[model samples]
Target chain A: MIRLKVALAMAAGIAAISSAPAFAAKAKSEEKADAAPIAIPAPPPGKGQIVFFRPGGMGFALGCSVNENGEKISSLGAGRYFILVTEPGTHQYSVKSEAKDTLGLLVESDETQFAKCKIKMGIVAGRPDIQPATEEEFRKQKSLKLVDEDDMGPAPGALRPAEIAAALAQAPAAE
Target chain B: MLAIFVATILSAAAVEAAAPESDGVSSADATEMVLSASLPEGGKAPLSDDPESARRDITIPKLTPISIQILKPLGSKLSKTGETFPIRLAAPILVNGVEAVPAGTEGMGEVIHAKKSGGMGAAGELVVTARYLDVDGRQLPLRSLHWAQSGQSRVDTVNTLNVASAASPLPIGLVGFFIGGGQINVAEGALADAKTAADFSIALPQVSSQQAGTGQELSEGDLAVPSGAVPDEAVDTESAAADVHQGGKE
Candidate 1:
């Protein structure tokens, strides 16, 4: 009887351990399905916006983190993008890896701009380069996804996800 | 002596005027030339619209292409990143077959990137973007001017030479290191086409309100704010109306 009880407890423990991964996998898939599409709204009055993206290509394993000043705004993984609303003025963004490249943009009120990051060959590892891009170029990449909220740092100047949602809600619906 | 001096001055002026010119006007003369060209013919009023039609606003739709010329020479070697240069319209902006913004209206262009040629066969590069056109003392945003150019690259030639020299002991490939890439240069008056960045609504200049029964002209104060100045009250009303319409849609 003792041996049977011990055997039963071990089997139960093994079953729970085995089922945990499957349950986690199911939850992850559900979350992904719920977050399929992300809509970006027009910038508010007196503000300008920029969309930064990284298309999956060479150096896919490396992260292209956009930084303003010294703080990390967000990490642009392979095939990911993020929108940042900014004040009307000059803004400089930089990406660093084995080397660093910077791009400066003159933002105006009620304007939307785009920037793209690509990996280039460097002396050590691949270097990240940021350049001015257009809306047409951005749309060419068909499989772009929104950067995960967890990947963002304390970007005080940027619009948060909650703010984006509120703005989208206030925007007029598409016909 | 005075006659000779006057003759010399006249000859110099004649030579300058008769010189073979390139695309656009000189930077120093751009504003004056544009202003004089845009002025009303025969010193008449600038607005040609009838008094009744002046009350309406003219909308310049988005993505309307405007031909512009750079006022000065630009190049990867001469330009620095983040610099703004003067530009002028090469053609007039038409609305309903009438000239709205005339040729020579001043605008601004910004250098987004400028990299001089570097060693090791790297080429010089330049990228410039149009910012806005100054129309009636207001900024009409412009965009889609992705004027970019790169100098000739010598990487392949350098690599070939290096491979050929590898078989010999003289290191002849080292000559490739001295060869520099070309520079991109946009001469004065070069065309840099741009498009309207967004929908721009310009308020037309309104005539003075006629004094009823007196047949007298009203004072300037009674006239609707001159061209392009949309009243704050009117703006607020428009915003309110837009909000109401959006709410109704929801």
Candidate 2:
């Protein structure tokens, strides 16, 4: 009788040990399967970049981009105009006119949509400090952060209304 | 209960993993850049009400950045005794890309000029043209033209004449409208005819308005207000301000 009782106790211990891992794994897997989902938001919009500028900024010049676009894209030009709105990708651009010439690259964003940008008319040559703005140069511009060079009279690139009017007063007849 | 909890957590984790992929772009969180610039109105002319021509044909070319001060010297007609008299008819000048003068500019019909049909002479109508440029000096393509403003009024027919050229995406050019209708005729005898002409000069951005007596007419009281001044637009926004703040390096 004593031997039988001992044997039964041993058998019960073995059964308990074998069942533990299976139960634990089942519980874990079930929890994983029932977990709640996470919420995700929508993507953002795209943007534009300035590609080029004239060497001697003065009368007129040119530039390029894959930035802005759409209806009323240009308030100045009320028509359907837009910049290339795309992911962060590279594009080719150029400028060639009777007065001047230029070339550059455009990097766009992939996450959002882009629109047509208002192209800056390349200015002619006259000013000494006026230099063309290239993609590489623009990169430096972002770093140094010269909002508008104010060392000069009204400051470089800064045109006062009176000055504009004066330019008007002194504007030579059409070429 | 524990099983249920564990299952819920696992499911939640899976869901989280599936989400956050709305943008496949690596720099999805980049800054929002807005590239806005002023442009010209070109391409096709607006349709008019003329029957002979289905399109109210208007052609605009991109005008360069040039400035001119308009001066109007009002002259009158006279009788045999040399007495001043009001003339009945008056005609407007026409040209391409010339905007209307803002307040404080010399006088009405100051260097007035406009004509759609080539701009050299008047076709008994007013026309305008202009170009658009960005703050950075980039220009729109010649193909994309829309509309542009010249700080002028278009509705006033009889007395006040102000007009801006319509533009498109490209800075084709601008031509403006002026006074029209009939010529200002003088009475049978006195001062032949009361002609309207502006005696103004053109200058570059370098000229000093003060030296040119522009201050005298500036109406400081009214001009100080920005209501009439040209608007300054912001440049295009750069990318990823948000991301830069996060995982991006300093």
Candidate 3:
């Protein structure tokens, strides 16, 4: 009887060892499922939404600083997105990686604009470029997870309307 | 009791023998050896200095020397030694069959050697060497030497003649055209078309492993050329001189 019991215990241990990896994978999937979905906030009166997103890059870890009208709004990493609600006007957006790439947009009221950011090989490392995103391209990225607030860095801290005004006041005129 | 003990020993031996062979060392033994080796070496083995490993790790693709045509013509009378001028690539630069730099990319060249036309017809010598190419907002070092005589001047003598004939009624304007003839006089900084002296191979330095981090800029040290390198054969100083002589005679 004791010999049979020992054999059963050994078999049980082997089975447990084999199933451990599957259990760990299940746990990871559960954690991913628990992550909150990205929510798009409604634009304020007379303001529109400007979304800057990087779908992918060769150097995925490189973060680029994104500035709106000379005021930095966020540092976006590859496969991450940042949304800003701003008053309708022409805003100058710049992405600074190895060099600065700027784009000007005439934002209209009650409309959402999407900018797709891509990383290109530079002489040193990688450079970031911001281009207008088509509706189809923007729709394809809807399922992507939004970047976490912690990874947004100190640039996002200056996104307030008063802070933007203060920064613009101190900024030199564009030559 | 002895029979049971022998049976147990036989079963254990059979199980051990059934374990799969892993080359020479058993799987467990190999794992243990790797772990121990890693621990003593600070969790990473020293990289091998073999040629294959070095090539795999640090090999940078050789950039084909681009053909540059001078936009602003260089002349001994106007161009001085050590003067920097702008140039344009005649053809795109390809690396591993992919276009790395497009045609018409602006480049900068330095007048390495120049001698103005002196009395006795010394055949004014001008040797210009390409310094670097402005690619995608980055300055990539390029090396090519072009030698020319005053004959290759792109100055449209016919056009000047036409202007001179048209302005003959105005003697003051005719003198201005004659004086400015065969001279590049747009401004201090201008691009003139010139010919490439030799085919140059662009040698980009290997990207350092440390610079793999985010936001690293290419430093000057990365562009140092290797010593004792042979020049590319595509340079035809004879042809360049002949073209210049032919232009000077015109």
Best by TM-score: 1
TM-score of 2: 0.14
Sort by TM-score, best first.
Answer: 1, 3, 2
Full-model lDDT for every candidate: 0.69, 0.24, 0.51
What is candidate 1's fraction of native contacts? 0.05
For model 1, the docking class works out as incorrect
Weakest 10 consecutive residues of candidate 2 chain B by summed lDDT: B142-151
RMSD of each: 20.7, 38.2, 33.5
lDDT of 2 by residue, B52-84 (tens): 322111112333222222222122111111122
lDDT of 3 by residue, B1-250 (tens): 9999999999999887665443586444544443343332233233234422222111113334456766666665677766888877777665444344578888787765454532211123444566677764656665423232232221223334434755677633233222321222223333333332233333233223332223233222222112211112221223323322332233
Candidate 2 off by > 4 Å = A1-90, A99-136, A139-175, B1-250
> Residue-wise lDDT of candidate 1 within B37-124, one digit each (tens)?
3334442234334554444455788889889999989998899998899999999988655456889999899998877765445456
Q: Pick the candidate with the highest DockQ.
A: 1
TM-score of chain B of each: 0.61, 0.15, 0.37
DockQ of each: 0.06, 0.01, 0.01
lDDT string for model 1 (A39-146, tens) is: 668888778788888877666788999999988999888788988888876677889988777777767666677888766444456566676666767778766877
DockQ of 3: 0.01
Residues A53-154, model 2: lDDT tens digits? 222121223332111221111111111111222233333232223232111222322121111212222223211111112233322221121112222122
Error of 1 at A19 (Å): 21
